[model samples]
Target: MSTDTDRPLWLSGHMAPVPDEIDAVGLEVTGTLPDELTGRYFRNGPNPLPGNDSGHWFTGHGMIHGVRLNGGRAEWYRNRWVRTKKLADNSPFLRDDLTFDRAAVHANTHVIPHAGKILALVEVGFPYEMTPELETVGPCDFGGRLTTGMTAHPKQDPVTGELLFFGYGFMGPYLTYHRLSADGELVESRDIDVPGPTMMHDFAITENHVVWMDLPVVFDLELVNGSMPFRWDDGYGARLGVMPRHGDGPVRWFDIDPCYVFHVGNAHEDEQGRVVLDGARYSPAAFTAIWSETGGPVSEVPAADAKDPATAAASTGSARLHRWTLDPATGKATEEALDDRGVEFPTHDDTRTGHRHRYLYTEADGGAIVKYDLRTGSSTALELGADMAPGEAVFVPAEGARAEDEGWLMTIVSDRAGKGSELLVVNAADLSRTASVRLPRRVPAGFHGSWIPDA
Candidate 1:
């Protein structure tokens, strides 16, 4: 058996587990903080219980680490595990009848505050609502209207204040779309057609349409026991569906190349009425390698052995910034490479959702945060050094912001050099460090997060 020191790279160092809940007060800041950036920055990711093997990174229990900022000072920091029914009962996801429990969700993927509720979301179960204080409220069904599972990546329309999201299932009625009004009412739910069930992690939205991804990563019945039961099948094919937002219009599905997209930066309608979507694209080989390593036990390989060409190819799979333009009129789709650098966890001003926006901030595969200029097709990055690995860079708009990039980018940086984690504040315009609030412990690098401003 592999010892703790011999564990996988992801289960070691800064990615290791922190067993207890923590409350930190009055964190020290390194530079001048933004006055208007008063709110809570909550990030959710898999922080599995110590001594228990989660088997896969995606299967770990969700833990949220939040930092509260007020009056240009770091007020407090707290880390809490989302206490769910599964955690409370110590039950398995599958019952004796071999059926899956919809409520036995990890709730580890993403967290966002919407309609006066902070929801901790996974794609497979009902959203668990949490308080602004980071306490778990319980699984929410949008007042019992949302019967099926909810998507972690929901698009909030700035123009309508409406939330647009979808759920994909292993069973029939494979895809469904939902819309919630500004005041948190579940107003619409419709079944969406797809070729089959795909791992649709994220989608895009334009002013008049919702974009759907029918990609190759699919659920396999035989591998249901694995942490991530889905595998990439080249023959499943890939396509993009564009559906009208407010009508029963037929969804226009345009078959695209064989690839997978995990997250989208933004989507908008151009002058020619073509829907434009940008995100991180993963090729077939990259998808295969990433999923392959995720299974089996967590065992760390030596640095020299990890650098082998074959080993590098297997483990170095990274998503590059890619763009797709779908012309609804012509039924034709074209793709372009925005930047050659590997990036993921893309974010922009939430108010610019379903609209044309210029700047995109993403975490680079390396230890850096990249800022992409869509209009100019230029790129700038802030390197956090080779020792520290940062999580997603969330864009928080400034008060009365005048420009698109006029805001602050916040991210949690994990120090590999023995120092604890810290929340970084960067100037969104020039990709420069503005301030950093030091934390008392290491915060593991996890998936998605949100910046919820004080109401």
Candidate 2:
């Protein structure tokens, strides 16, 4: 058994891993559930085994928590660990030749439904397919056409239905972009040029282009045996790349200030032909502090002062909503901070993805779900109190909806005391509570998830 002092911060409190999996039926529901929500809410996260710790919070085995709803009823709930070779047979990720066995990864970052299949995804490996019942169907490589690892945050065009994503590696071909047909076929792949390998977490999309984030946090050979093999390098400058989706033109790169963005809210081409990208941005001080506390290498820059209460609060590496406008004509970029609050997991309506969006939704570190009106420059939030921790809020459009905000936001809220968990449904227009289904167990604070409506 591990004591509190010996355990890392990721293994304790709200981020603690659950030991086993179970199922329950006929969960309790508070308030009225929308009848149109007749599908499954699947969330993927890192959950190590009972006696195992994967060194870093991001390296645990993937576990999915699923909830089924139908006809205003909470039908059932179940949790399952994604059965990968790494989890079952202790397969090595890095082979003897220094190449990676893509199947031997955690697959713990995101769970998304694309084409007709549900995939459990991690940035470093091939995606593992999962059944609607949460059973692993093994790894998928798009008929072996995907030579590189798949990104967990693939963007499916709301208009063309083609899925666009990219993969980055610590090798010569550091980055590669891929596209999937509407029928899920690997149609195109292109090698992108970059200076060095960096930890590129997420990107954005426009109607006719794909956005890329080339940040400064990079892999270190000296730290390969440590908890995380990456560290912040000030030498590698940051930039955003815009590549034409269907054209063979080279990527248009726009230099920007040094910052790290883990999640992008949305991106679109403006009337002035500038690509406007919105995301959660973290400063150097903020990233260094949070990275050190989360089992990562400490950077040369000093972390925020923990002795000062105000500075300590900012040390959580809380990312604020920021926007960047890149002009293709002038080859320049402009940035602005949209809000001052600390938030993460920025989400927008799927229908408006890669297009001009009026609203963006995010969860605050203070246990609140915030809704931002980008058009009016205002925001509203539904506070869940200090004892509740909510995961990413996924937007589900209403049936025959006309307005973009006419939808519901679904999230799994966990009790800070580890008492229990619940699936919360809130009206997107007003941030009002529509319903909440009490879960049978405490679902740990997770990464990303999706809502799959019935066909």
Candidate 3:
């Protein structure tokens, strides 16, 4: 019954920092649903949580417990794998939401408030698109609800307080275990595969081995959409798959295979399983940081274009690679020359005092946010950025009557004129600056965020 709170307040999740304000739902939806949509952030900096309405946009990473149970109000939650497009017949936007072909919200539900009730889940967006109206064809029509190309994430069942479900159903990097219950049901399901889902994407389980990343995928563009023109990485190979929390056969494979470009940026193990990978490297990029306990971080990737094929055919081009570390026992390498800063604090960790773990991963045009530092050193960054520079920050503390000792790090400032989304609030441990909540309404650039700080 540890009510966690040494002082909880460190937030930033964004979208709509430019183009006047992209318009996911702001600037008042005029003239038939604003085009090129953008704006994001469910809750913007400085402890925002009041009648909250930005609709929804939380790409990934969400589920922090800190010291508080549920009422401590810092439980945290965020999820998104959703894809509901229809740029006019590009497909995937079903439902009668208006009239679109290939539609699928996969999973969508947002909330934030803790130690009292509010740390829920459901946001299985898109994973290699598979729709028959979204599968599961054995249900009703009365209320009609059958969608499970599966995609869930939430952990906390050292012994079951519920909420212990990890899913995957768009195939690979395998992970599917359920026991949600708490009104959401899914009781007990199976099928857990972890043998290289071709560069797995999200993971962090520590009771005993789930540190992950056997990264190496050649191509599957994740169902093609905006960019990623194709090329999963031919002859691709990278293994470090460790699946043993209660694993069964072949769950402890490690073969960083003549690996070429490992991009796994987070993993922690220390009870003797000995695995630590925080990768970033491929075709002259530079930033290798591997501490492999002995198995392999893999390697063998070199071919094509050598460096910059016209910004690699411009997909918003960015390849600062080069960050290595592989010592499963002498497979060594190390490099770090990345700190363009747009987000800075300590890199990653202490999502709420997990202590300090140091995990800062950056990838955009769509989504990527990795920050960790529970209470030590994995070599921190505490800040990361990508996407029109930077436009999301938050940290507000001084409640009850607004006491003020400092708390507020809200940010969003895009000068594109589409309508810049603004909400500046700073000072969570000297982030510098303070106050400013201007918004004429116009948010669109969606993806990632959750901080209902008292609602």
Candidate 4:
């Protein structure tokens, strides 16, 4: 636990399995996002220092970043480079068994201890380094062959409590700011506002709009917008906006429906600021959209994956999850109440700030944590099933926890058969059973996780 100079600049993310080791296997994760942006876009972090027995993690991709070393029980996993993403066409390729090795997925950046410090915000790309000549003019317009890229998001900075990241490296459009001191072993720093490189994902920053949920023909956002030449088609329709991070004036749009892979949790406003989109997911619910300022509401939640055609043709994909009640100002809609109750939806959810709504699901067989009592429509299950796999759960209510503690959930318990991935915990109301470790294998489903209560 000594990377020397004292340790505790952690940022952790995971997804494991199939390790004869090195070149990646089945679902991967490694870290680095002080703009060394690594790959595989989902799950990886580090700065976890205490016992530091090589828990080393930090991740980012599409503008590279690294650092992966999760050795425990048996051992055999390591990779280093304090930092790299100096964009020389941002390279990191060599696929042996090949399992997504670049794109630096996300999740884990919502901590802000305060005074003594503990900020570790994340979202990446843009460590831009030599690789210009397809028509230079790069620094982070999202161009430079993407070499010097950034465009990442995951916010939280209500002021000095630090830990607010928004990326686009190679020195453009940054907003990074980390602070963690109090002798846990780490100093401090800054970065703010930002201008160039823009593709900010699923955002929500209000004191004056940064509100994001974008998609306007991404061939990687029009190949970094040099002259707006087009050809990209990572198509997902897209539109749900708000601007003025420093202004270009009126860049507001909300045509709704086209949110390919969306998730906007914990947005607040009421007492007149208006907005309230307690939860979201555009597909899997045929329809979804909501906003506020005296408007926005769309409802529909009463799932159906199929009645019985042998798991409905293997669940064709309705997956299942419904509980609608969009009140976008009198558009008035309601799905009554679990209609007939019988679910298998919500791949992720963890919210709090009122009307009581706590959902985190995954099923065909297991993983759950549901508690929604939005005024007695009632819905409570608080935990369930074999080595639960509550997809994306995290609800940290009450500051510093423990009141019989109604806050705890950090998941991943799927086994691709030995060393696939297994990191579980559940007790956020009824979902009993705390700590359940089983990562001697299987982890290629690392979508998100966080629970560093002053560590």
Q: For residues 255-337, what per-residue lDDT tens digits would candidate 1 score against the true structure? A: 88777898999999999999999999876655555665555322243233244556446545678889999997899999998
Our tally of clashes for model 3 stands at 94
Residue 400's C-alpha lDDT in candidate 4? 45
Tens-digit per-residue lDDT, 273-295, candidate 3: 35554443443112111111111
Would you estimate the TM-scores of all the predictions?
0.94, 0.97, 0.25, 0.29
Residue pairs with colliding backbones in model 1 are: none
Clashes (candidate 2): 0
Model 4 stretches with alpha carbons more than 4 Å out? 1-55, 59-122, 126-141, 145-165, 168-202, 205-208, 211-271, 275-367, 371-379, 393-412, 415-441, 448-455
State the lDDT at 95 in candidate 3: 46
Whole-model lDDT values for every prediction: 0.85, 0.91, 0.32, 0.33
Error of 3 at 301 (Å): 53
Q: Which residue pairs show backbone clashes in model 2?
A: none
Rank the candidate models, highest TM-score first.
2, 1, 4, 3
Return the lDDT, model 3, position 349. Answer: 22
lDDT of 3 at 403: 26
Against the hidden true structure, what lDDT does model 4 obtain?
A: 0.33
Residue 388, candidate 2: C-alpha displacement in angstroms: 1.0
lDDT of 2 by residue, 1-455 (tens): 76656788888777889999999999999999999999999999999999887788888999999999999999999999999999989899889999899999999999999889999999989999999999999999999999788988999899989989888888879999999998899999999999898999999999988999999899888888776799888778889999898778899899988878999999999999999999999877678777877789884453323334575465567888999999998999999999999999999999888999999999997899999999999999999998999989999999999999999999999988778899999999999999999999999888999999898
- Candidate RMSDs in Å, in order, are 3.9, 2.2, 22.0, 21.7
